[model samples]
Target: MIELRDAAYDYGGGGLALRGLDLSLAPGSFHFLTGPSGAGKTTLLKLLYGELRPTGGAALLFGSDTRAMDRDGVSDARRRIGVVHQDCRFLDHLPVHDNVALPLRVAGGDVASRADDVAQLLGWVGLGARMHARPPELSGGERQRAALARALVMDPDVLIADEPTGNVDWDMSQRLLTLLAELNRMGKAVIVATHDLALIRAAKAQVAARVLRLSGGALSAAGADL
Candidate 1:
């Protein structure tokens, strides 16, 4: 549950990235946001996750204005949302499983009690055997899946993936899309921001997902063809 009401964000230096954005995401809903480079797709995701507060209008998460929240409030709000960045920034020195478990560790979770969960998630992402591999040892697809597993380690209510299929091949992109669709079926609200029209179209066939486009600092519904 995230809502933006006529939200406007100025990036300072006399530049406005978002202006008068009105978007709403309900529970269990899946959405795909596509746009050109510098179209503010990532900025929109940051707004939903409490990383960026709106400068002019309302940016609400589960009914609360993000600008009104304190530091702890923002931190707690993030626990309900999982984010997968395009870069898949994993610790180079840590094993894959440990990297996946880092979120829980940072949140002060009793990781020992949930070791099986980490393993299960890795298996779900088709990376069970590579648990002991380091980040440098993983392929691009493997790295993406590992990042997804790490994000889901928190069991977040909402999942925000930014250009998730960017670095993978077509087949691997389809696989990742299927995994995201499955999550939507399991009731995790999903928002995938990507530039790949093919990936978005493929995902639409697997799940009931809305495609939105960001252009000139605004959001609008787009056709499946993109």
Candidate 2:
């Protein structure tokens, strides 16, 4: 869960990208953050994942204030909160399974021992047969699903996805949302930052989801239209 109270982030000469943004994501909760191109949607996602610290007010990840957390504290909190970035980062030279297992390997877990889990996750995302493929070899949907698999490898408490379905086709977008909804059903707080109202509406039809709009440096509850 993430909580922000009057949180403002200023990028020096770039001026303030976000200001006075008040929001909270509770356990088992699902939210859709919608905004225009220049809005601070991605910035808000980074704040939730501890990539950016607020210049003013509070940004809490779990129960600790992010501004007060040391490197170790931030890293520890990240282990409990999984993130799927918009770009869908991956090591081009690594296979899908190894890429998905990177977090565990970094946390010093026995990656080899969890091979079954990794395979299960890949299959869950409909990528079992492609687990051995490199990032460049997969299709767009496969890449997104692979990223999701990587993000969920830690079995995180909170899942933050930034524009996950932005570049994919409609079918792939729905597939990705279904996966996210299933995770929410499994009790992970989910916040997806996207401008895709159609996908948001589709997700709403499948589960209880809240819509929040981030625009003009403020956050407010949006109607179902979002």
For candidate 1, write residues 144-195 as lDDT tens digits.
9999999899999899999999999999999999999999998999999999
lDDT agreement of model 1 with the native: 0.91
Candidate 2: what lDDT? 0.90
lDDT of each: 0.91, 0.90
C-alpha lDDT of residue 202 in model 1: 76
Per-residue lDDT value at 133 in model 1: 100
- Candidate 2 per-residue lDDT over residues 16-95, each given as its tens digit: 56889888889999989998887889898888888999988899998899999999999999999988888898999999
Minimal lDDT window, size 10, model 2 = 217-226
Q: In terms of TM-score, how similar is model 2 to the real structure?
A: 0.97
